[model samples]
Target: METNTQTDQVTNYVYIHVPFCLRKCSYCSFFSVNFSQEASSRFVKYLIKEINLFKQKYNIKPKTIYFGGGTPSLLTAAQINLIISQFDIAETEEITLECNPVNITNEFAKELTLTQINRISLGAQSFLDKELKVLGRLHKADEIRNAYKLLRAYRYNNISLDLIYGLPNQTKEDVEFSLDEIIKLEPEHISTYCLSLEKDVPLFSKIDQIPADEKVAEFYYLIRNKLISAEFEHYEISNFAKSGFESNHNLCYWNDKYYLGFGPSASGYLDFNSKTVCHPERSRRRDHLIRYNNSVNFEIYHKMLDEKKIMIDKIILNNDDHEKEYIFLGLRKAAGLNLEEFENKFKTDFTKKYDKVLHKFNNLLEINERTIKLKSEAYFISNEIFSEFM
Candidate 1:
């Protein structure tokens, strides 16, 4: 275990990664795996031990506790409680748990409600059976409705539904239909993602059958217009929330706030004074999360979590990188980047640095007094515009 400090001196958020799944997705590639109950049990014990070390090192209670994962729903409510009991989170803190429809039951939802788990992120990739099969999802279309009904019956209001577009053989009508059902459900939040042909995934092998980039872009615009017209806030590129339901955990990542991640393949970030580590990478999937372990492989992760360690394995950001990170991450939000806030974090004039990139990409990006936005047309080409920062 190691210790670090942020210049801000604030302890705000913590993330718990549950890298266990009933089964892995064909298109998915994150740290997770199928495992036995005994293994899952051991992993929980290890998580608590690791967290205790973190608490001692950081010396603060996290205001937000997020359980993100391969499939947090795989754990029984009792197991969830046991893992959470180890943390000293504030009573009013936001606690979230991610689940798939297949594991969501009335009993499960009820137990979660009683366990201080206020937020539920449902992996309802699509309500269509065909899409589910193509995506290698285990849940059926009916399962999705049942899952939501169960949550709603438990009086759970802070719910988020995930949607995926650009699937193979999917049509515009398919995307619209899914969105229509989502709008009718009126979930507090919706996270829309375009499928990426990630390396080594089963879905990546059938790349030729997937929707073309142009068609995928069309659906992207469709989602934005539909969600906006339905009164959802396009708070981030991939997230749409109703006013107050924006994801606090994800915000930590985009805003570069300090957070601790527990469980295998999970990465923790602590701000230690002037310098910081932005993104951390993992090589193995979190199989033991399903079956709890005594401890995560700390030595492997120490390099990434070490205080003020330079962000390597990808492009390193200088002052240009910082300015670009602010713009890139900031534009993903509806409020956009606060210029004053940007200047404060990077200690550089935004207009003075990367003026060429900003100027050349002006049509694609909208620079307001307090915020920078991607024009409606640029949302599809957002990656290209953001690449300028890189």
Candidate 2:
């Protein structure tokens, strides 16, 4: 990591990347390695060392801690506890751990109850056996159900389930079946994703089987309507939650709050200062934001930590970069971007700054006195709209 400048701000949110998985899913593109007991144990030691090094530099009292993966649940409960012990987490803090349904054994779930992980995000990709097979998921449909029941048995009330739609050869009925199963389970939160085929993934070879954009739009509305009818708030484009159960850690990202990231391939955003820029033409205050990601290669990650050095790729954001990110990331929420907040933060009139772009898609946006957001009907093509700001 770069040396902390005099103005670096403290971050309350922490994300630890656990990059070990038994098998990588066919359509996944995240950086991860094959899981092994010896490797994971060594990774945990280095992860803790990395955390302690940061702790020495900053006073970190984490309000939310997230362990995201390549299947975070693959770590033993004792290992999870050891990493978590490095933080001073309050009972009210949201500590989330992502799990593969097949890995949520009875003993594992029971042991997790003893840890500070009060929330669970289960990767129950699909409830259909065929879809699971096509996606190269290790768990079957029954395993998803059993895992849910097991978590409930262990008293984990704050659970979120993940579902993927727009799969190869997927049908409206297939989506409905999965949604029906999800509703029946009644998790506190639900995150839905459209299968995106990356360049080198196995699913890219079968991209021809993917549904048309129009059909995918149909699926999106189908899901939004179903989840809304079931009383789940469509908080973000790809996330829905029951009352008071939103993922606090993820909310930090959409809300543009500073956070710290640990482990290989994890990225973090931090603000150095909130002072106005010294440029002659611009009068707006700009956040001195810096974003960095750890090395993706395991060997380099370990070597740097062993030498007490932080190996990261870093970027310092200019005013334009910050403004574009503010617009796009804020627009992801259902409540939309607050115009008042934007004008105050950037010291520019929202309408005057993006006048031409606003006129281009006037019908697709819902603008009012305090906030501006995309209309629900225009969500499927949101990326095209977001590009205007980019």
Candidate 3:
């Protein structure tokens, strides 16, 4: 494996994890807890200390910052600002916060916007009342509309709304109605996903009663047609964006660029020169900074941090590891990979290395100089294609 430190590039994206929520949704398996104003205040203090450590150690400055669940909006505006103040975020940086519509008010939206958090990703899930109840979302259908209207009234220009299909007892008409409602709002971006029944969640126990595959496919087709007609680009399998409105932060991940992930359950990756970088299936380097997974227990996290053993898992990437990752992560984007770039990373043509697999599955995967996107027919079976390399 190549070990050249000088040639490696530094990552400029930073992700901060906020693991507190007002309540747990049945479909959610992410780490989050019941809301506590005092706990949030204390968490912010530790967060700042952690950020300072990064600056002192690596001298890294971030160009994009993302604040993800559990219910980032549950945090007070002051606490959010406290965290933001620590980073020398570039003027053009895209800062995003994820929120459940129940906690979003006009005042809160205005305050967050003023604090330079220009983008808000509202977990709207659905606009149908019965579906919202079944999903255990606290917000009502009207509340979703009202909260979005409030954001617009507060002048939030970059807003993304999340919608879910494949709800139990849902029909084609119901999915279309959800898309219609989303189109009416004209959000800058729309993320449409199928309901995933996670293990140990309440929904998982009742998964058998969920919509059948045939109906689920119908709902997916309905969403594709509606959103495309509405002029939103189906940039990713699950993300739709208008022109110049694609999510830059998310793109960083799909493009396999380096990013910093902070907070419990958040993961970060950066390239290191001295380390032996292995692929995700065979990685074992724990220096060049750490892979910090914060605890679901904030108290435990605090105690661990004070003892300087807060890192839950850490792996440093070597050239070969980074090269393999370029294939897996790059394939996630709709545009796929650039052939020349792949050659530069691996010092070999990826197509040449996998020619046998490519030749055998030519009809199923689209391979070209610019990309290797899966055909629409092969999308649902992507795992089968991805496994060929391993």
Candidate 4:
């Protein structure tokens, strides 16, 4: 891991987590509690405290701010504005708020325009109400349409719609219907996720109902081709966007840049001079790069902040860890990983170090003079390919 010795530089990206939802989705595994006015108000106060604590530690001039959540839309426009006021944001900066369709009322959209928020990511998981019911979403199919119209009426040009594929008993026509609606709406960006039945999620009980692996792959390719044909760039594994509208905040993550995360369960990565030793067995030498996660328990989070103590699990990254992360994270982008840049960063020849794994997955990967990437057709099995590096 390279040491960033400069202490004057500002961390330009920030992620604020709002961990309260009206209802937890059946497939969600993220940390969130049922929404309550009193609890949410209290959470906001503590969230501001957490932000202030970090402000004292780093010089943060945010270029991109992302409010992700249990449902960020649940926050009042004033609450959202209070959070944004903490940063020195420019008009050109991209500030995105993820919203549940049901929460985007006309009045809410009007108030949002008064804030610094420039982008909206609407959670429209499916165009069919039946699928939404199956996934335990609070809104109906019509609400998604109404929400988009409402946002547009308030002059929100940068909007991203989310879609989920490979639902139980989902068919080709089902996907086509959803795709047709999405294309017609012409959102500035689109994110598509394939349903994964994690054991901890309520949806896991119906694991057998999921489509076969082969069918899921077909759905993936179908989505890719449709979005591409609609003039959207397939920029990342699960994201597509119109040119110049690709998510700058998400791009920061994929490009391996430093970012700050605030609120409970939020995680952050930074490169700085520190005396912390990650591997005491190897040497007592300081590690410069570290990733830390705030406590998931809300009570502990508030208590630590109240006591002016940082409650985080921190991991110092060594060269090997950094190299693996760079490969996996960089490969998630459609542009792939640049071999020259990798060698420059790690002081290792890419071809020489992983020659065996490279040859093993030769046909699935695209290797050129300067870059290496998975072929588009092989994206469905990217996890299997990434495991070789692990």
lDDT for each residue of candidate 4 in 169-267, tens digit (9 for 90 to 100): 899889889989999998999999999867999988888888899998999999999999999999999999999999999999999999989988999
Per-candidate TM-score against the hidden true structure: 0.86, 0.94, 0.89, 0.95
Tens-digit per-residue lDDT, 1-390, candidate 2: 433432345668999999999998899999899999999999999999889877755567788999998889999999999999998776338999999998989899989987889999999988999999999999899999999999999999999999999999899999999999999999999999999988999989999999999999999999999999999999999999999999999999999888889999998887644232123433353535678789998888888788876525668788789889989999999989999889888889998889898999999999988999999987889999999988
lDDT, residue 76, model 1: 79
Q: What TM value does model 4 have?
A: 0.95
Better of 1 and 4 by lDDT: 4
In the order shown, what is each candidate's alpha-carbon RMSD?
Answer: 6.9, 3.1, 4.4, 3.1
- Write down the lDDT of every candidate, Cα atoms only: 0.75, 0.88, 0.76, 0.89
The order by descending lDDT is 4, 2, 3, 1
After TM-score superposition, the amount by which residue 359's alpha carbon in candidate 3 deviates from its true location, in angstroms, is 2.8
Clash list (residue pairs), candidate 2: 1-310
lDDT of 1 by residue, 311-369 (tens): 22222334454455557787777666778888787777776776998899877777877
List where candidate 4 sits over 4 angstroms from the true fold.
1-6, 274-287
- Those runs of model 1 whose alpha carbons end farther than 4 Å from true positions after fitting are 1-9, 273-323
| Per-candidate clash tally | 17, 1, 1, 0
